[model samples]
Target: MIREPTKKKETSVTGCIRCGTCCKKGGPAFHLEDKPLIESGTILAKHLFTIRKGEPAYDNLKGCLLPSATDIIKIKSQKSARTCIFYDEESSRCKIYHKRPVECKALKCWDTREIEAIYDRNRLTRQDLMGDINGLWDLIEDHQERCAYETVLTLVDEIKASKTDPLLEKKALYIIQYDLQIRSSVIKKGNVDSHMIDFLFGRTIFDTLKSLGMNIRRKNGKHLFTTTIPSDPQPT
Candidate 1:
């Protein structure tokens, strides 16, 4: 029998140990360039989740945590671990290897220049996915514009401006819980997937408020919003 030659593996960047650490760390952030994979059914909307603008996320360029200024679409991770959903531990391979997102394809552990170039670029927004269909997109936009974070911020600001008001605390609590329910209702309506709801809303009301330095306390086993650092307080 004649022997056949085995072809060598091709790698664009060096120092790939194939340990899958990057995949374990976090799923790849998707971009507009990745629409082809979705169109081809290699990746689906159900497989993705949104990280909304104004949420705390790692900024690789600055090497610090900052609010994401734009919406980001990312692959969901396995429930058991932070690894990419497509990652198979038993085989130590990507299930969608041939049609992986651009981020996965461009990643190079050693050089990483290609990946970094696309990391902080503009992301696909809900509107980006909108075609002629107005129903879901309209709902998404309405919910986003009316999200509780802004209302909470306004309430907090008003309270700060008038420190003499004693009723502000009660008002804040009412608004917080009300906003939470609003989100719940939208989710229950199912016009948009729950995961999609999360991304479009940015961080939840609790998280966004916390990031803004609002003091949270548990009262009767219910989270109560308390004081927040004044935007500008005159030094006593």
Candidate 2:
């Protein structure tokens, strides 16, 4: 009869402790239900960015990187970090907690069933918000067409196949140049807020290419491309 004293039962975490872990990782993607928040000015467009259709992005739920099927409008991170812009580091709380996005409300870190169920449902797109706006929407549409990931990826594949096609390289470079030029023109000529560039045109081609393992640099006023082996192959 060498029975020891009974051990204390461990308490399970059933609610968000506001540890700021989720906020630190990144902000939630906006959904249709969160449209009111943006429309009502609870969430501003300047605070957001878009992961445009066909862009390669990390899928948290699926735990892999893949091309987005549609626009995934999300809150921008603070500065150079992944921390949500609304996250107040000192207090470990969301500044807009009372008006958080649908995904933020649905997310339960302890039991992710709620989040995964609605992760990709009814995602809000830039068109839904600004389709009726004159000139701006047209600009965005043009940018999407000229700087599409589909065309870029195709050029990348062709470059890999030929390994020395200067013409293919030139086409890719032109697309990158157009992408940069449009963002610059929008800010300087169109008088659009520079902060809204990411939301309008998604990320720049430089970032997109780098994420896909291609590096570009300027030498003697000309851009040079260097390819590196991607650690993860494109998800099937």
Candidate 3:
């Protein structure tokens, strides 16, 4: 008796190995197509965080640092391992595999043609997700105009260089506090929930400024702004 020939297996990275490499890193950016998942409770709001436009963040797919070009909704990761919150290490599988984000569905590590094709298409914006709430849309637009972060940074430079008067620091603090107050007022008005405030604004302005090595403190109902002036002069 003779046995039939064995079929040779195809060698391609296109097929998932369940190695959990991608999931271990972080979850995918949610697309507009994934709005239903959030609405249906398949993906919880607690499982997400926003990457604000112009914010510097790591681009996992591209393996580089780049500022977000548009506000993007992304899934949160486990604080301990920095992996997707839905990823189950014990099972080596995603807990929500069946209902993963659109980006996750399009991802093909071996060949990224599919994901690349729709990378900029159907992107979920912060406004798209939460703009329906009354006053929230208007608040976001107003806050952006009121506190242009780049402009704030420029103000900081002016203060440090003494291009502006010494009292300019006080003025700058007033502006920053005013921005915060605007957000506070919006929250108090009951347009959006307090818990969801951060979602609407993304990371707070204080955090963003802190990342630039600036210190902000509120003492005795007054804001104090302090940052070291670089001793080395910038090249012209």
Best by lDDT: 2
Judged by lDDT relative to the true structure, which candidate is superior, 1 or 2?
Answer: 2
lDDT of 1: 0.64
Pairs of colliding residues, candidate 2: none
Range of the 10 consecutive residues with the lowest summed lDDT in candidate 1: 1-10
Output the lDDT of residue 56, model 1: 52
Model 1 ranges off by over 4 Å: 1-15, 148-179, 191-196, 210-223, 226-236
User: Which residue window of length 10 is worst by lDDT in model 3?
Assistant: 1-10
Model 2 C-alpha lDDT per residue in residues 1-236, reported as the tens digit of each score: 00111122244868778888778777889889999999999888799899899887777666666788889999988888888899999988899999999888877667767777888799999999999998989989998898888998887777767766779878988988888898999899989899989888888887776656555787786677765434433332
1-236, model 3: which lDDT tens digit per residue?
A: 00111122344765878887667657777778999998898987767777677665655446555566777777777876668889899999888889888777777666667776776577788788778867767878777666666666676567667743658766666667876787688678766466566556666666665565555676897766645544332210
Tens digits of per-residue lDDT for model 1 on 201-228? 5446665555555666768957765544
lDDT over C-alpha atoms for residue 221 of model 2: 64
TM-score to true structure, per model:
0.71, 0.89, 0.75
Model 3: how far is 135 from its true place, Å? 1.7
User: Comparing candidate 1 with candidate 3, which one achieves the higher lDDT?
Assistant: 3
**RMSD versus native structure for model 3:** 9.3
Stretches of candidate 2 exceeding 4 Å from the true structure: 1-11, 226-236
lDDT of each: 0.64, 0.80, 0.67
